[model samples]
Target: MDRSAPPSPVSSYSARRGLFPENEPFAHGWLSTEGPHEIYYEECGAPSGKPCVILHGGPGGAINPTMRRFFDPAKWRMALFDQRGCGRSRPNASLEDNTTWTLIEDIERLRVHLGVEKWTVFGGSWGSTLALAYAIKHPDRVEALVLRGVFLLTEPELKWFYQGGAAMLFPDAWERFCAPIPPEERGDMMGAYHRRLTGADRKVQAEAAAAWSQWEGDTISIRGPEARPAKFNEIDFAVAFARIECHFFMNGGFFPEENWILNNIEAIRRIPGWIVQGRFDVVTPLASAWALKSAWPEAQFDIVWDAGHASTEPGIVDALVRATDEALRL
Candidate 1:
């Protein structure tokens, strides 16, 4: 496949493709990790077909049904799982032993346990970060990569979203994000939220969780509040999402040094890859995607003009599906 040429814009067509019809996993179960955590996983699509794994965003984001629609069930054996402390995973939201390195090991464990030798890796947002980490660590096991809303968890990226770069665009939502923290502590928003989120006071934790999670929900879509996922409002989901995300962000994604993903890009440079990014994604933004592309030019890069950070956006859905379909030929 000639990845030299960028994919034509999806909006250029009369009709843009949407997600595949909703489908359930044919097989689902929990895998016990070396530690106390037990990860939840499900498999859908053809039992004997091209293998692929879908990594959901949020470092804390759990798997959702809509994620299954990105691939052709008849042609792709898709695997989706909850990373460490989110979704159906056991000990809900417990940050015990959770780190970027542990999650990468868990992915390897899942691949071996499922009997998949080499499979395409599909991820977005934080998921995209994990996918890159995993591919770099175990390049031989990855056949290809499909990434969206690229987030490297770099200091600047974190400062932009949590500190105030995104705030410049959504000041209203940013005001609410800052409301939980006092003016004095506003200087370090993530640190302030982390202290409250991980603090002993349940009331404080819940309050910070709601505010932190809602902030992401409010700005995730180009369509605004109406398009934000309703799940973000639930306290249980917010706790896991905010806590884990905060934990990772506060700790610099547990990376040895900053810019780890791009520094290690050469490890997977030969692997087939696709990067789908939203032109107006305030959450992950376009700069990270452009940076990744600059480092790994072999991967196909597609920008969805009408989309934002969320995968459900029509343009993103079309571009992702098209990327996955093209991976089938590999």
Candidate 2:
């Protein structure tokens, strides 16, 4: 027990942020979406325990195994899945039938497929948008929500990141992101990027995909220069991510109406939710999360001061774990 001596292995614990240890999904499989598209999904923790779901970011981001760790295996039955056109889903990066509503339908379909009665929904970044959309659409099926780095997918929020607002914080990264498109096309970054990302030229698509993905990686986490950005180099993964993200953002998330989340808040007001946001999150910004909290004041909100947009941040990881635990209602 010497104060200065290294702690023994039995007593030692991970200095990593978050209360939960990294765990693996015990089972996984593919859920076929409408058409040839198949969505990849996994299950972890006790089969008869409280239900929970992980809504991954990127609109096209894959579900990381580490995301399964947020819940205690003994206390929860958790589900994590990749949206259409991303992750282990087949037909890598195909944009056919991929849209915001398509994803919401996919979620409900996954739940029915899993036989989950109701679940505490967990999502961050674009995931949050999907989570909210799903909750509003089917309030009876949602037990609760744990949202991080919230993105409402509003037109103004789109402008903040793609247009000029976030550029104020990371001018260098923004410069690189904007460098690919001509000035005339700069007025619509999403439209401009979509052209190259979906264009016939593989070389051009790959280039735009990397640049688009890198800009997000570079600015998302406030980690030091030594910390590596999330890997987005795989051409297929990059292209799908960039293209789907641009596709959603350009079409304003394909919402039936503007400010859709707020407009439909009453439907989800009774469904409890907790927001964990980074104060310095340039990717989605804290303001949007705050606005969501304001609209849905029934939800719990936390602002992590030292974190950025990535849920990988220590503060966010811890907050998300706590929220997941809280959702159990025990």
Candidate 3:
């Protein structure tokens, strides 16, 4: 297989289900969420329409310009922001006071600042994790939820990807992912990598950061081989990404308890949730998604057989676009 080529999408989705035409944000600005860090936010589509906040995945990934196309510009208002140490947010990659709880509050502050009474929330992967946490804590403010690649961030799920479970399926990539650490350090991959990712050694940090980011790409690329994709554009971005991700994973996402979302399902039971997951996602597997759906039986679930962990997967894009359309009825 040509590892260099992009994966062929496996889907029966029609062109009609594709993302809406390219649309620029109507307004964009940075909101001061904490002492020195400002959450970078932008509003797209109709300013007065049903607002839906889109949380970009990664404790590090920023919202792409085209992401707003998932919603109908005429009927939906899209609000997107880069959490703590990511995107255009200042003090980039500094983990000062960054936590899952802080992100949840940032969402609320953004909503309050925008004066949106209640709005739909959409997220994928880590974004899904934050969305659920926010909704669970402030259910009254969430009109609905559209989640993709549900990630509960449980101990089991973390081990699956970091320790060995996901490694079994992608041994080649796993081999590379484990290559950076010493034999003794393999037992604690996150801690081992976190050490280098945050160390004072610039060379060590960049190496670990590149390896960490490539490992993620390999696991999510449904059609690619286990190989380092490419050098990250900047060492700063890579370090921040690897550092923040490892930070959250190391701290169990800063949750007060494990399975917090599942334990507090009652809060969002009537909040009208929609779950879209890829059958083959290695990062946040179907098991996590299924568990979430089981805990919140009222949320509609869609399993995209042809997709993988990436929210940009073709089948996933179709499902997400339609999911946004469904929100119009609410």
Candidate 4:
């Protein structure tokens, strides 16, 4: 289905590298975590500074250059990595050993590889999911958290994304996303989309990809009249994106049948955290952020009044930048 949400009324994507000058010529490389996969990452800011890892969204989305702006070069060392089988990483969406547990383990391995005893974790959307899972598994290794668009991977959240919960706001996009297939296929939405999106017919793939991208874009971002269609590498982006999300969806996103966050609330409650949510976020509702606040009453939750899901949204980006700066102070 079209999972792309419209960009917020916010003006444009965040400027890259302009925020930090001294950290010129950022470094990029791969880290072999001694696991089944190699992770692609970029390092900016000060090497000897406090360590802060940034996780990008999408089970398959690559880390953009703007992500580095969240950190203060003089105060914190910033690390951004495309998760396994994702951007920069080899074997994109290979599905050999990619799962939530594998990703959690990957973070621990990355920590040891980076030679850090403890470091702060910063992530948004699916990245937030990985951060929480990693922290819960190894609480002592996490100094703090800066979570945005917090997603708990609960059944309800999954239903909202795949089913019709958010359709009220973007029914046109949703309808287009599901149009490539027959009515019978709607029940197994992702499965049906996967078949046509990966089918031999170029026409079918193009239609499915466009529809899916448009649907997601409409809800997440506010499109302008002059906005053109997004052009993606079908094999590299569309196929991999579909497989990874489906892999997680069919398996219920690797979360326990019950809400693990609620089940283990007491443990994560003590961890220092800042929850950032967009008041108008259709991808992940504000309710999830409030629910998280209820579970960890001490953690500060910031609501960006006019923003949606995209971190690049002006208000949300500002909050994330502030969160990064806050982490550096500690």
Compare the candidates by lDDT and give the number of the best one.
1
RMSD (Å) per prediction: 2.6, 5.5, 4.5, 5.5
Ordered by lDDT, highest first, the candidates read: 1, 3, 2, 4
Off by over 4 Å in 2: 1-19, 224-229
Looking at candidate 1, the ten consecutive residues that score lowest on lDDT are 2-11
lDDT string for model 3 (2-36, tens) is 11223458523455377788888889898986577
**C-alpha lDDT of residue 164 in model 2:** 84
Alpha carbon lDDT of each predicted model: 0.92, 0.83, 0.84, 0.74
Q: Give the per-residue lDDT digits (tens) of candidate 1, residues 98-154.
A: 999999999999999999999999999999999999999999999999999999999
Tens digits of per-residue lDDT, candidate 2, 1-330, equal: 012233357743355346466667778899986687998999988888898888989877888767887788888988988898888897788888888888889889989999988888989899999999999998999999989999998888888888888888888889999888899999888888888988899999988998888888777888943343455767777888888888788777898888988888999988888989888888888889889888888898888777888777777787788778788873
- Could you say which candidate leads in TM-score? 1
Ten residues in sequence with the least summed lDDT for candidate 3 = 1-10
- Candidate 1's error at 151, in angstroms? 0.6
- Rank candidates, TM-score, best first: 1, 3, 2, 4
lDDT of 4: 0.74
321: Cα error in model 1, Å: 0.5
Model 1, runs deviating above 4 Å = 1-13
Clashing pairs in 1: none
